[model samples]
Target: MKTLSLFIAVCIASTCYSQLKKLPIKKTADLHAFFHYTGKGERIISGHRGSYLKGYPENAIETFAYVLKNTPAFFEIDPRLTKDSVIVLLHDATLDRTTTGKGKLSDYTWEEVKQLRLKDRDGNITPYRIPTLQEAIDWARGKTVLNLDKKDVPMQMIADLLRKNKADHFMMVTVHNAKQAKFYFNDNPERMMSAFVKTEDALKEYEAAGIPWKNMIAYIGSENKPANKVMFDLLHARGVMCMISAAPVYDKLATVQERAAAYRDIFAQGADILESDLPVEVAEAMKQKH
Candidate 1:
């Protein structure tokens, strides 16, 4: 048993390093052009879950339109795959967490899932059906940058869909391990994959893969996250640009005001692309305060 356990640990570590080697992270010029000016010149304010306010629906097309009109804010939506292979816009694995439907989503047909309504963060049912990824993309054709959130599904379809729709106006982000990043880039070398990073080690893994790490957005951990100075310092040294988030788990220090403050303090610390629930606040904070 002891020998077997030792062998398993070695296998796991080997698997990790091997996977990390597959990523095609870009270097110098290739990466810089992508992540260089995230939220800088563009006042693009993307709303979370389609601007989930106290009353608006989350992931609903209507809610997105409202956000686009009401504020300078753009909408951030999600794409998930159903058992039948249809891509839908949702934020949870189980519908029970954010919708009136019960049971695992994989167990239901696309039609059945569509009948269910989405709920707010507070559990109030809003009038939103699970929109297919294609439908959401079509709706926002020339209007906004569709932020695709891939929790765990491999991203081949997303690349295909983007090319099909000519929807090159949006930015995508995912939380990825080294192996996942490599596999994503390798599956289709022509496609772009964005990810979130919390540590210098993660950054190295992504950069090593030769993928364009600049346009690649990273999430700031809820706790003990590397400071922007530390983050930029490492990335700058590599000549790779980066984006920061107040996510991958929200923290008390992650208040909108604080993030905006961080945006101004170092200024450059505010990720090249600043993703926030309070897009307006961030814009005003960075534009007005700084």
Candidate 2:
């Protein structure tokens, strides 16, 4: 009996060691380097709604998983509250467009929300269903980062959830202005935030608001060309990455050549990140330029 017990203990120890070896450990400095401007201008990609047009359901964990596996990109997922106050991944106020159900998302309880199947970008019902915010957070651990786009939920509530899950390191919350940035920075200075910094004046405003520049990715909102060279230079100088969103606008550019040209110009202007509906395409374009 003693020999048998020893053998079992050895087997369990080996199994545990093997499992630990399989886990991917992301360094904090590396994650910061990926999202911050280092003057070298390393490019990053964010999948808008998790590559929804590539047959994956928008805002679904499966879609995000597919993106991380296929491309070196992070995912932007929208989180909204259900009737029971559970936060879940969703892009619209109503579930009619993305799901089989026809009602306001907040009107449905989580149990009911889980039953509705998600539709593709083309409106075809897929096997995926709405995932809870916690579910997405769990999936992102050691895999990729998630950019939380503000929907109906309060930023404080979202921050609380991130703290609960110990996921603040692997996610960033969207902030529209300096005031929002200051609000979040005051809560936890370590939290990452994405906000618009369209001009040199915007940078000055952020400084005056006491926003943490090290924990920010400035979204220089420009249609085609980069927002402003001075703005880009200032952000980079302060070690803040400049993100150019190519969605619902530049993504709809007339032709493939035009879109490609626009992306090239964005990089040439020293933009560190590209948030795109066409994440895979943008990644490929970046690769070709390199």
Candidate 3:
């Protein structure tokens, strides 16, 4: 009886690991190149607000396509879950502001939410329909990298979706703080974090938990900088990359030209990738020196 029980246990363990292994995996270079890691340059242009600066809709599929075609600029979009547990592209806690729809966004399901169109910041309603995460993945495949801004969905769902769709090759996951990162990673360590550079206590906790350093991206907002070169240095030394705004603090910057310049300067600080809303503008600026 003991031998039979042992045999069954081994079989179950083997099957579990096999399934885990089959989950999609992404190479650091495949992701690194999406940021336009030129053999000689500092940062790759990132589309801020999904090319919203160019009149493209934020978090819209068309905007993603536009950014992919115009330049190597990577795309950024936010994800929020509707009431039914279906994830949708949204930035706010409610849809009353970004959409023509009324009431709290969480009140709707993917089916119900899909009926409404997105309204631009100017109040001109776009023809684009709301798309699910799978649709977004299909849109992005072989074209651009996805900077996933996880807002509402549970981390378990994110992991399950990645495992189910085998999507790790095209997307990077981020958490606002280290505690969230720990919860997500601990639940399923197979997933990865491109950035979680918030607290040393969290960092120490992560290290102590035996999670490998290579799995997390590092970031630090410098007072001298939004987060200075030290952010890059710390992460680079650990063999991971750092995060910077695509066109961070654009309104605060003295001028659009200065904002574009900041993108490159962040790259020069040793950042492997940059996130920007003004990708086309910055791309043009970078082209001048070439």
Find the candidate with the highest lDDT and give its number: 2
Runs of candidate 2 with Cα error greater than 4 angstroms are 1-28, 254-258
What lDDT is reached at residue 87 by model 1?
Answer: 82
- lDDT tens digits, residue span 1-290, model 3: 99999988986643322322111224654553433323354455556557664245678876666555556655667788889888888878877766778887799988899899887656678877677888887766655666677687788888788778766666767766667677767765645565556555656666776666656655454222644554455555556556666444752477867766665566665665566665666666666652
Q: Candidates sorted by lDDT, descending order?
A: 2, 3, 1
Model 3 earns a TM-score of 0.77
Clashes of each: 15, 0, 10
Between candidates 1 and 3, the TM-score winner: 3
* Segments in model 1 whose C-alpha atoms lie over 4 Å from true places: 1-35, 38-44, 71-76, 168-175, 187-190, 222-226, 236-241, 247-269, 284-290
Give the higher-lDDT candidate: 1 or 3: 3
Worst lDDT 10-window in candidate 3: 16-25
Error of 1 at 34 (Å): 7.2
The residue pairs found clashing in candidate 3 are 47-276, 48-276, 48-277, 194-217, 221-227, 222-227, 222-228, 246-275, 246-276, 247-276
The sequence of per-residue lDDT tens digits that candidate 2 reaches over residues 258-277 is 77777877778778888887
Question: Which of 2 and 3 is ahead in TM-score?
Answer: 2
Give the higher-lDDT candidate: 1 or 2: 2
What is candidate 1's local distance difference test score? 0.58
